[model samples]
Structure formats: structure tokens, C-alpha cells
Target: MTEKPRMDVHDLVSEIYARDSRRVFSTLVRLLGDFDLAEEALHEAFAVAVEQWQHYGVPDNPRAWLVSTGRFKAIDALRRRVHSQDVREQVSKRLDELSQVNAERAAREIEDDRLRLVFTCCHPALSSEAQVAMTLREVCGLSTEQIAVAFLSAPATIAQRIVRAKSKIRDAKIPFDVPSVQEFPQRLESVLSVIYLVFNEGYSASSGESLTRADLSSEAIRLGRLVMELLPDPEVLGLLALMLLHESRRAARATPEGDIVLLEDQDRRRWNRTQIQEGKELVERALASRRFGVYTIQAAISAVHADAPGTAATDWGQIVALYDILLRSAPSPVVELNRAVAVAMRDGPAAGLSLVDNILERGDLAGYHLAHAARADLCRRLGRTTDAQAAYERALELAQQEPERRFLKKRLAEVV
Candidate 1:
């Protein structure tokens, strides 16, 4: 007869990491009363768990164990700082009190702490960029390197951003609970934008060795669901739909070797049917209410792409019409660039080239990588080798992502 080994220890550890991450973070936030300190405490506690869990066996309540460990670390860190004697004594007393607190009460307190931490990170007082970096680091549990990829910045730059954001949170005395209904819209919009940015970064990494970061995309999706649950709105549904549609194609967006695969060239058969179905459902629901935002419109465009059986079969005219609506709703250089691509598809490469050249003369997208790439593509289509070669070289010089740079270089070589 075989005995089932006690749940594999490594598996148990991983489960603990997942189930208790928020709890650990929340408890640390309360104990330290600072986002950066809380995060530092949480990691220190995890380090201890990795070392001690194997010897002690999994605790009956893994989250409670981690929370307790983090709280202790927070107190120790405070005590190490040579503050006023009264401050030191107060912290010592608090540590003693924490040791005596009941585990059940601590767990309940941790929930409230997490809610407070969320509101604080998403505070309207902070700039949108700061709010995003802070919330992702504090609420979504992303490391600086992961956030850097998401923000399209160097890791050091991201670290500085997070540091400055936390300092602002502390200095501004940002409230730690949800704002009143009157204040909710502004705060929530900031929060939602951050989540969407996270999803976008993962969906199409601006620059990375890998084309995607599933962890970030999943985290953003989870955060979106949570946001919608807490405060359901038409815009929230629009964001959810947009993310679902984008994520559906993730499986087909890159080659086996991690090269970029343009949407038209992607293997539709490789798309996630379930995600596509769910996304379509959301888009339908959002559209039924007759409340279409930028996200909804973008999702609708993606839906068109998803529904088409092949590139040649695509409903380009409809897409061009939608882009017309989108431009009015949210006029940006990037949106204009995308509109140019759609126009090229519906008309001809020459028409698209005219629009792109007009834009270049305006010098609005001079530093934009996609503009150069788009021009190169249009020139290639028109069989203008000299123009194509120069455009590809320009794109290669401006391209940030390694894979995209490779793509541009390949195009240039072919032209040469």
C-alpha cells in the first residue's frame, strides 16, 4: 500500500506565497505605517519563510504566519532606527502589543489594512505616474524590474519613481480608505488607468527579451476584475473587454523564437477561443448600454480583427469608420498613426504613405518608433526600395525593443 506524501513542501510553499501575499503586505503596511517599509518587511518575512518553513512544517494558517513574521520585522526595523527615546519606547510597546494580539483579530485587521493601502496608493494627491508605480508595487506586488518593463523605463529609473512616489504618499498624508462618492471618480480613473497601463505593457511590452509578461498581464486582469467588483461602471466594463480581447491574441502574437508577429500574419487558430468569447460578451454588454468610451471603441476594433478569418477577409472599411469615431473621441498622435495603418489597408500603400509623410512634415512623431516602422512598411508595399531602406534604417535606430529592432534590421537588409 502506498502512502501519499504530505503535500509536497515546495508546492505548499508556493501556495503560501500566493494565498498570503496580500495578507503579508497588508499586515506589514499597518505595522510599518509606510508603503516602502511595509514592502521591505514583507520580502524579509518571505525570505525567512523560505528558510524556516521547511524545518517547521507548514503552519495551520500560512497567511497568519507570514503576517506575524512581517509585523515582527517591521517593528525590528523601526527599533533599529535611532529615533527619540520616547519614539523608541513607543515602538517597543507596540511590538509587545503585537506579540499579544490574537491571530484571528490580526487576520481581520489585515483586510482593513489592505483596503487602506489600496486607497493610499491610488490617492489623487499623487501624480498619475506616481500613483501607477506605487499601486503596482504596493497593491499588485510587482518588483521594480517587472514594473520597469511595464513602464518602459530602466530599472534604476523605476526604482527612483517608486521611491519618490512613496515619499510623496507619506509627505502628502494621503488617506488610506476609499474616497467619498463625490471624490471617487477622479481617484478611480487614476487607478483604472494604472491597471490598463499594466495590462498594455504586458500585452505588448515596449521593450524586453520576452515579448510578453504573463505575470503582469494576469495581475492587471485580476486588478481590473477587483476594481469592477468594487465599483462597476461602463468604463470599467470597457477596460475589461479591451484587456480580454488583447489577451486573447497573446498566444498567437509571437513566433516560437520570440520574434514579433504582426496581427495580420498571426495564426488565428492559435488564439484563445475562450478569452475571445468572453471578450465579445463584454463588448456586447458594454455596447448595449450605448456608452462607448475609448476602451470600448478600441475593443470593438479588436473584435473586428478577431472575427475576420484572414487578413484578406478583414472588414477594413468598417475598421476605418470606427477609427474615425475613435479619433474624435481620443485624438492622439498614436491614434492617428494607427488610423494611418487602417487607411493604408483600406485604400493603398500610396495613400497611407501620403498621410504618413504629411505627419512627418508636421514633426509630431519624429521620435516615435512605430511611425518609422509604419513608413518603412508602406514603402516596402509600394516597391520603393530606396525609401523603404531609409525608413527601415530610421526605425532600426529608434526601435527600443530588441525584437522590433531585429525586425527593422531584417527589413533594411532585405531592401539593401
Candidate 2:
């Protein structure tokens, strides 16, 4: 067996940070009873870890050690604040509350602290975007820039959303715990939405040089699994199935050189059949319940595509039908755009082009790069070179991801 190289204390501590920082943070959040303070404690603990671990070697339980250190750091800060007359009473009360909460915290459920944190971050008191932003920032440990790239929004915008979310939580003093069974239904949508967005960003990065953020997607999948274990809701199963099905194509979604690979051109042999099978099984389970929603229907569409031998053999009719149901249930412009692409395959490019025109005429998805790219593809297939060129140019203009931009530019060149 090959021996692993010994890392310096600094490097080892950094590795520990990458692995256990979020777990430590979660425990500290439960102990400190405040997000900002918990965050501060997390960093302080890490800074202490680098020095302490070097002098005493690594601890047998790094997470527990860090959690202990972080809680003390928070306590120290709280104590210091207690001496300030301006906020003495307020700080003293907070310290008492923390002490009591921490005492009862373990008996309640310390192991599920991260899950509780997710629910708290996804609280209904916040806006949809704020809920998503906060969960990604805190639970997933994604950076502000990373979240911004996934959302295709400006970093400043994402940062401000997160700031506002934290302010709301602080000002309102939202509890750092999971919702009750009755409260689950109300908070479920935001939670699911946050996970879905995370998966989408990881599955196909919205921007950046790389085509995929595998780490982020894997985290989302883990979160999905965790949520399913807790709730097993039909929609949750559907979402999990949808993500697995889509993720199954990860190997074939791009060239080894990191260029984009259109679904029709991807090598089916390279697909993860195991994930496909599991995803299909999940879809069946969700469908059997007769209570599934858009995600389940979407997974059904993915299953049809997965089962196909090739593009020509795909069940475009089934896909279009599923999209129809999704549209009726959700009724969004993006869904209509997708349905149009399916129609183009099931019917003809001309029929699909008509739908695309109608959507564009209504000023829907005008800023969406995929909508333009879809139109460009239909136009190209229909031999409408002029229209294809224009659509591809528009898509290229809007595309932020390097791979997508390259693909659109290539399409534009071919049409021209």
C-alpha cells in the first residue's frame, strides 16, 4: 500500500476546516443560539485549532474539540458584552438564555443540528430568494460568490439578500430549530426549492469556466436524502428522483476537455445506469402515491429519455405530455419553453417555432439564455439559417457559462 505524505500542521488544520467546519458551526449555532455569533465562534475556533493542534498533536475528536472551543469563545464574547452598561442587561439575558438552551440542547437532538439549521434558514418569515440564499450560505457552506454564480445574479445582489436574511432572523429572533409536523407543510416548499436550486447549480453551473460543480450537487443530493429520511413526502421523493436522473448523465454531459455535449450527442454507454435505475424506481414510488407534483412528473420525463436507445427512439410524446401536466400544475414560462422543445421533437420544428414565437411575443423568458438556445436549435434543425444565426447570437450574448457560450458561438458560426 502506498503511504500518504505527512501534511504540516497548517495544512492539516486547513483540511480539518474543509471537512468539519460546517459541523462545528452547526453545533456552535445550537450552543451560541445566534447565527452571527456562532459564525464568529466558528472562525475563532479554527484559528485556535491551527495553534493548539500543532502544540498538542491532533485531537481524537476534532469536531467535538472544535465545538467545545467555539462555544467557550462565544461565551467569552457574551461575558465581555455583559460588562457594557449600554447593553449590559441585554447581553446578560442572552447569556442566560444560551446557558439554558445549551443545557437542554443535547436532550432535544444535537445530532440533527444541521437539519434543524436548514429548516430555520428556510423559515417562512423570509422571502423565497432570501430563504434559498440563507440556506445555501449557512447549511451548504457555499460562498457568496458561489451562490451568486449559481443564481446567475450579481454577487452584490446575493450578498445583500443574505445580509437581509440574517438581519431578519436576528431582528425577529427566529428559533434555531426544526419546525413542528404541522409546520412542515408550510416550510416544505422553501426547503425543497433551496435544494433544487443547489442541485441545478451543481449539475450544470450557471457560470464559471467549469461545466459542473460536483461538490455542490453532491451536497444537495445528500440534503435530499436527509430530508427524505425525515419526511418521505411524495414531492420530496420526486425531487430526489429528478436530481438522481439528471445527475446520471453527468459523465456524458461534457467532453473530457470540458466543452459542452448536447444530450443528443452524448454517449449513452457512459451514463450511470445504476443512478438511472434508482431514479426510475423513485419515480415509480412517487407516482404510486398519486400525490406527486412537478418534480415527479419531471423525473418521469427524464426516465423516458434515460430508457431511450437514442435521440430518435426517445419518447418525445411522453415528455411533451409530462411537460403539459407540469405547465398546468405550475404554469411558468420556463415550463412552456421546455414543452415547446418537446413539441418540436414530437411534432416538428415549425410547430415548436410557433410556440417559441408566442412565448417571446408575450415577453416571457426574453432574458433566459436557454430559451434563445432552444430556439436556435429548432431554427437550425428546420434549416432557417437566418433565424438560427440570430437566435444563436442572442443566446451567446446572454450565456454566462463558458461551455454554453462556446456551444452557442459554434452554432452561430455554423448557421452563418
Best model number under TM-score: 2
Cα lDDT listed for each candidate: 0.79, 0.85
Cα lDDT of model 2 by residue, 102-173, tens digit: 433442254578777888888888887898788778876889998877666899999999889888887898
**Per-candidate TM vs. native?**
0.76, 0.78
How close to the true structure is residue 352 of candidate 2, measured as C-alpha lDDT?
A: 95
Clash-forming residue pairs, model 1:
none
Residue pairs whose backbone atoms clash in candidate 2: none
* Backbone clashes counted, model 1: 0
After superposition, the stretches of candidate 1 with alpha carbons farther than 4 Å from their true spots are 1-17, 23-33, 36-116, 124-132, 143-164
Best by lDDT: 2
TM-score (C-alpha) between model 1 and the true structure = 0.76
1-416: candidate 1 lDDT, tens digit per residue: 12223556667667767766875786667666677677778788888877776666666766777777777787778878848989878777877876776645555476666666777777767777777788787787778888886666899988887888777766877656767889877766777788887787777677767678787788889888866665567777788888988998887888888888888889999988898888888888888878668888888899999899998889999998889999998898788888889899999889989989888878999988789889999999999989988888888888888888877887788888
Cα-lDDT of candidate 1? 0.79
User: Per-residue error at 385 for model 2, in Å?
Assistant: 3.4
